[model samples]
Target: MSEWFYQESQTESFLEREFVFANFLEAFAFMTKVAILSEKNDHHPDWRNVWNKVYIKLSTHEANNTVTDKDRNLAEEIDRIL
Candidate 1:
């Protein structure tokens, strides 16, 4: 997706993006919202939050940790969450 960056390792590929919030609480709230949606869609993200920033990475683990349509779709949904 336009908002994400593509990354690859020797054995895996993923899409990554970053979001910044006004404060830690705001960022945590956003992450909670994303977690619920991820569970509902059965597609969880690899993510971390520090202070006001949330970094997210998406990949389909069942697909050998590669980026797939599932990752793209999830990325779009995550954007909507923002």
Candidate 2:
């Protein structure tokens, strides 16, 4: 939700969010949860992790990598994972 930002450019649009954890283990656990959610929803996210921080971007690949309802819904679900 409020923590997520919408990013757009000439070629793509996506919902972006960053999460910081107390340690790398916590961050990895968060990513694991997200992975499960992605599989259940059949919507994957582009993400990167470094130490205690994880950055994520969500978009619909079939929709030309643009932000869509699917992205929004998945973002909401991601919020709940916290």
Candidate 3:
């Protein structure tokens, strides 16, 4: 997968990804992992969950709407967990 970090805005660009899990348990497990990483890095993702699906949109709040290395790094971590 490409490690491309795009700028964040009040749009849905960051929501266009393919993340699938077999069941709710698997999805919740991934979310738990992500939550820990987010706390460690102090960078949270705007996300929602419905059953087995997770929607993630990341942005650097202190950096306005621009995407930074931190976002990419967190995304890598998330990909690893998933």
Best by lDDT: 2
Ranking by TM-score, best first? 2, 1, 3
Model 1, residue pairs in steric clash: none
Write the candidate numbers in order of decreasing lDDT: 2, 1, 3
lDDT per residue (tens digit) for residues 2-80 in model 2: 9999999999999999999999999999999999999999999999999999999999999999999989999999999
CA RMSD of all predictions: 0.8, 0.5, 3.0
lDDT agreement of model 2 with the native? 0.96
lDDT of each: 0.93, 0.96, 0.72
Count of steric clashes across candidates, in order:
0, 0, 0
Candidate 1 vs 3: which has more lDDT: 1
Model 3 residue 9 CA deviation in Å: 5.3
lDDT score, candidate 1? 0.93
lDDT of 1 by residue, 13-82 (tens): 9999999999999999999999998998899999998999999999999999999999999899888877
Q: Alpha-carbon error at 28 in model 2, in Å?
A: 0.3
Q: Judged by TM-score, which candidate is best?
A: 2
True-structure Cα RMSD, model 2:
0.5
**Candidate 2 lDDT for residue 48:** 100
